[model samples]
Target: MSDTTAYSKKTMRVLLYLQQGELTEHQIYSFLASRVKDEQNSSVLRRIAGEELGHAKIWQKLTEKEVKTNRIKFWFYSLMALILGYTFVLKKMEKGEDKATKAYRSLITEVPQAKQISEDEDRHEQQLLAMLDEERLQYVGSMVLGLSDALVELSGTLAGLTFALQNTRLIALSGLITGISATLSMASSEYLSAKNSGDKNAVKSSMYTGIAYLFTVTFMVLPYLLLESYAVALGIMLVVVIIIIMFFTYYTSVAKDLPFGKRFFEMALISLSVAAISFVIGILVKRFLGIDI
Candidate 1:
């Protein structure tokens, strides 16, 4: 039998699809590598790009067919790498390869190269990805500091104000004042902490922390600003806090190799627990002071 006849038609189609995918990924990775400022990260991305091209070449030998990379896919992922950090972009791409990996597994008997590529996907690519260093990830602790504090502190503050003020506009005003003050305080604290730790980018760390806190504060406060009922606004604010926690947890999980479910539940539990306690305290304070504002 001819070497080409060894592969079933289904196997040939799969090989062709893998060829196109690998070539497209190669271009995307190469483009991202060029766009990054960090030399180390650039080197890593370039290496991954080369490995992807090598995979494409292996498939080329099997099919004896040339496949062109998809320009549109390369451009789309390049845009994503530019907007979202490359860490997120790469991890998202890795997740997409799960389906391809399963398909390759099915063709391993007829295509030895498929088994090798699958192993590379599971071992080499994942290991290299774990070694990638992105600037945003370097300051993840600062972001966590800001995000956790804002979710816990602001949620509690809003809940307390909801009962104490009993008016949406008044509650929003009070929460804004408190949130602004806390944001500045948290930023200053993080700056000092980073500086004391001898971090060269202390200023940047503080900026990231402050920006994260400020964004969370703005989002959580928006419902109260827009709605007229304090109860409804408070309810919506809590929901927003949960969403922020979920997204951040997921992002951290993918970038840092942490577990999403545990992190998410822990953060949500703490933030909600604080808010619930503060809410009860607000009711007590309102009654004890005979306040009606």
Candidate 2:
């Protein structure tokens, strides 16, 4: 009996969904393979793209139906890969594959090829994904160092300054001066550390670190720069800090395969705790010194 004749309507629908997804992934991988500069990375992407096409063909044979690729998903992942780096986009796709793996396993009894497809999804794809080496990911340590230090130090500094100064302009001025100095310090420190460790990419690592630090500082200090009320600006700056933490933590989690919740909460706790401590100190200093701003 043929697959289309033997399967129910629901099963055929499932096969079609898987088929469309595979074809979309194939296109995304192929596009990335073409765009990637590294020869090895390009080869891996092309190989994966071929495998995805093969998977789509298997589904096509089972369903005996031609289905168009998902254009939206193709463009979305394509744009993301272009902007965020292919390693991140490919890792994110692995999460999607988990769902498809389950779907393939469900059809194993009805479709004999499902078993092999599921195994390939579980093993081969994962192995190939591990082979991808993107430069941005390699400097993740430097980026993390810059981001984490900026969050903890600047968040606390701004909180203290917000209370002590009680003027948005003054707070912003102090924060900018502090942030700029810290950015340079952090960048130079990273450069020296990388060089000392005999890393050939020392300059690149430091640049990433400096850029990450400066980016965080810009958002953290923006509210004070634009707003007149120090209290309101402080509130907004805290929100901005959380947002930055959330975004960076998510990116790292997706790209590095780390647990998101744990990393995010840890960073948030440290930054907020330091801010709270500094805020209290600001209040104490103002009271003890009898200096009215």
Candidate 3:
């Protein structure tokens, strides 16, 4: 009754690899379950963790191999859940699972149970993950509002300042002052808007928006602070802007089931376009005003 002759050596190797991955994911889900505060959410996580273990056991029976969980990935994902919110981590993990799906497809025809497990892994698990209630996700709109405005507005400001002031230190100082004032203004506006809309979490939403805006401002201005050359700082800041766009786009794409490439390109295009236009305006202003500062 052993599966020794059921699969070839190569097939067994693939199954064993999947076995370890499933076990590792199971541990990750279990750890995440322990960290979640909501009892219903915890129950859902535990249910998924049990299913992941069940999938690992299926692979074990097919391969007749004992697998150890990857402790490093376990800890890494656990940390990600804590820092990035469990919904974000799970969405990221689901993307990673796409690679494993190919491996699972290989066993579907060969192993009868593979079909059900594959379906569960691809469809059921994802649906359940989508159902998980995470507070941060609910406030994603506020974060997006803050982050996007900061990126476009501040990137344009820095681009103009770089050309106009032509001094890294001066630009950094000006950008920080501008960014701080804008952050406060943005937070207040969000609070008022949310409150007018009858949102009970108005303060929390504003906090998320302000925090996101401030974080973006800090990154966008960092190059100016570190570098002495205005041109070099501007170039590095542009690169930082693109990176921030990519990271946020990917996060939203996965968590919200949106298209990554389209969102990324659109945001990049708009932000850079604003910067380009502002740069031109800065040149014009500098020439006309004849400011030496």
Q: Top lDDT: which candidate number?
A: 2
Better model by TM-score: candidate 1 vs candidate 3: 3
TM-scores across all candidates? 0.92, 0.95, 0.95
Cα error of candidate 3 at position 202, Å: 0.3
Clashing pairs in 3: none
Screening candidate 1 with a backbone cut-off below 3 angstroms (N, C-alpha, C), the clashing residue pairs are none
RMSD of each candidate? 2.0, 1.5, 1.6
List ranges where model 2 is wrong by over 4 Å. Answer: none
Q: Give Cα-based local distance difference scores for all models.
A: 0.90, 0.92, 0.90
Give the distance in Å from residue 217's predicted Cα in candidate 1 to where it truly belongs.
0.4
Q: Which has the better lDDT: candidate 1, or candidate 2? A: 2
Per-residue C-alpha lDDT of model 1 across residues 80-156, encoded as one tens digit per residue: 77876899889988877777987798788887667867886669888889889898988899999999999999999
| Displacement of the residue 184 alpha carbon in candidate 2, Å | 0.8
Off by over 4 Å in 3: none
Global CA lDDT computed for model 2: 0.92
- Candidate 3, residue 73: Cα displacement in angstroms equals 2.2
Residue 137 local lDDT, model 1: 89
